[model samples]
Target: MRKFFLAVSLVLTSFSVFAVNSSHCPHSCPSGTPSSNFVVFRAPYTLSNNATTKFADWVAYRIAPDTIQGGRSRNFRADPLLFSSRTLEPDDYTGAHAQIGTDRGHQAPLASLGAFSDFQALNYLSNITPQASGLNQGPWNILESRVRGLVQGGGFNEVFVQTGPLYEFFFAELPGANERHTVPSGYWKVIYTNVNGNIQTAAFIMEQTTPRSSNFCFHQVTIDEVEARAGLNLFPNLSGASTVERRTGFLRNDLGC
Candidate 1:
């Protein structure tokens, strides 16, 4: 049993040096990552953690009709696979909610994997980030729901979503954290699906101050633009420049943006 647990630990914290093997990602796990970022696979989603920020550099997951069920577990905890120096505990978010109007937002939302019994992995702090309450509850929350609608509404077989934070400018520190954990300046997301044998993609970048009622379409960007801002090579296994190039009005109508 001890050997089994040891092997499990090795598998869970598998370094990104190996190609990520998960059903959740689009083509392949994002490539061209920072040295500090390490990959950890959970039952529901896969994330690359950034030791510097004590947060994920990026998270990839797929949402299907059946996956979006059940209520939020909300049982946030530290990731056992990460070192305490590179991860946050529940106390790290103590005063943040009220003092800074920040939220312990899930990069891989729990609601998206509600159908799975082990969805608690989504609650791990390594998969959570300090996001402004307004942004987390407002446009960001809406966008997450929109992705689910695509799967539930039968508009797509499944929706592939990749998201991460942006540090374009200085950010505040989480008041409750004993260690330094800088808040993200903004966030980025890329949603993609196959339509008629062609890949259609939509991307967006939202600041921490995005209005709750903001129009989601107004923030639409290209995959390449998000790559530059977030320092990630998204969907590297997919071919064709059209998929990565900026599309001013790509999939706006389908997304109801």
Candidate 2:
């Protein structure tokens, strides 16, 4: 078991390194502080910790038609699981210059998890970030709606969505008193589906500042780009994960719907 775990870890890291365009960090991203692997899995999604940045390294969830049947509206709040000292509060984004220019963006959106508690859980501060007003309400939102449609319309047996933020090497601060909170320069989403015995994946990234609003496919990229930029090695427990073929384009007409 020990050796097996070790081997799996090696393959997972190799996937992060080998799949990326460089053995070194990307142009603007730096490894100033390594992220945490403290993972917590819940009804809506699973997230790995990045306490230094006070956000999840990544948040992944599986959505199906039944998942969005019903949910109650709830307000965003701090994650009680994290210590108060290290967690973000409602005030963090409030007041002058604070979250003015940005929106309290959802990494894994609330609507994706329609059950009462899970829906509310998506509002936890650990899952929130400051997103550019335009990006959040514009192209980013349009694609999110499209993804939800694809699932709720029975587009696939199941769709797994993983999302998270990315920061430049030095990172940026939220405009308020909570300077500890980092403002992501960009965000990413990866969708995976298995239909008719075929596995298909589509991954994308867009700057929080100037994401394209007209075309979703314009930003589509290989999963390699997403993982490398965030410095995360996802799904190490899956043995064949490393062998999955990485593709740069979406299979629209060929998606075997």
Candidate 3:
């Protein structure tokens, strides 16, 4: 009887790990990701960690109205599933804020799933990037909040978000980081959700130098543009063949453009 129970527990554990929301990735996770990257599944999200960059190549999550939680925490730590050398420690950002005006920015965003018990998984270093304070705390934050607002305001049943760093150029190094890694030149985010029977997407890219007072809508771009810059084909399963869908300006009405 004990053996049977143990076997059942193992099966349940495996199922739980694989059961992280399928909608989080839309039809599938980004393809053409670097071969060095490995996928990590958490309760609230899934991420592909780049071994070379020591940061997530992309973090995909779903935000439902009820999942939006109040309050936040900062218990950043290394992902235990990843090799110690392949992930950053909390110390990596010790003096980063004061020295470089950067923050341990979260790709999955605590604000998206703060109400859940596994919300801390968003704090894992593998899911973080050294985003500039102006970008991380300002426009970047505004974008995150707005994404949550879409669901909380009852506009959508769920919102899917995929975000990652863009190494267009190397940025400053962390004061406490011991591993060799490239800081991002910028960051990109692609948000999508189902409306009626159609799918809508809004993508944006922001640099570390983006003005704190600037509007996030001003930085919006096509999914193709983000794919070209980041080298990952996002939302590949989405129907159609338009490689580059550029908008003259932010035109997604639901996204408040």
Using lDDT as the measure, the top candidate is 1
Q: Write the per-residue lDDT of candidate 3 for residues 199-240, one digit (tens) a residue.
A: 667899999999888888889888889989999877666666
Q: After superposition, how far is residue 18 of candidate 3 from its true place, in Å?
A: 16
Query: Which candidate number maximizes TM-score?
Result: 1
Q: Could you arrange the candidates by lDDT from highest to lowest?
A: 1, 3, 2
The parts of candidate 1 lying over 4 Å away from their true place are 1-18
Each prediction's Cα lDDT score?
Answer: 0.80, 0.63, 0.78
Per-residue accuracy of model 2 over 135-198 as CA lDDT, tens digit each: 8888788777667776765466567777888886433466554546566788888776767656
**What's the lDDT of the predicted structure labeled candidate 2?**
0.63
Please give, for residues 49-113, the per-residue lDDT of candidate 1 as tens digits: 87788888889988888788767668899987777887899998889888888889989888877
Tell me each candidate's TM-score.
0.91, 0.76, 0.87
Candidate 2: regions farther than 4 A off: 1-37, 69-74, 96-100, 169-172, 237-245, 251-257
**Candidate scoring better on TM-score of 2 and 3:** 3
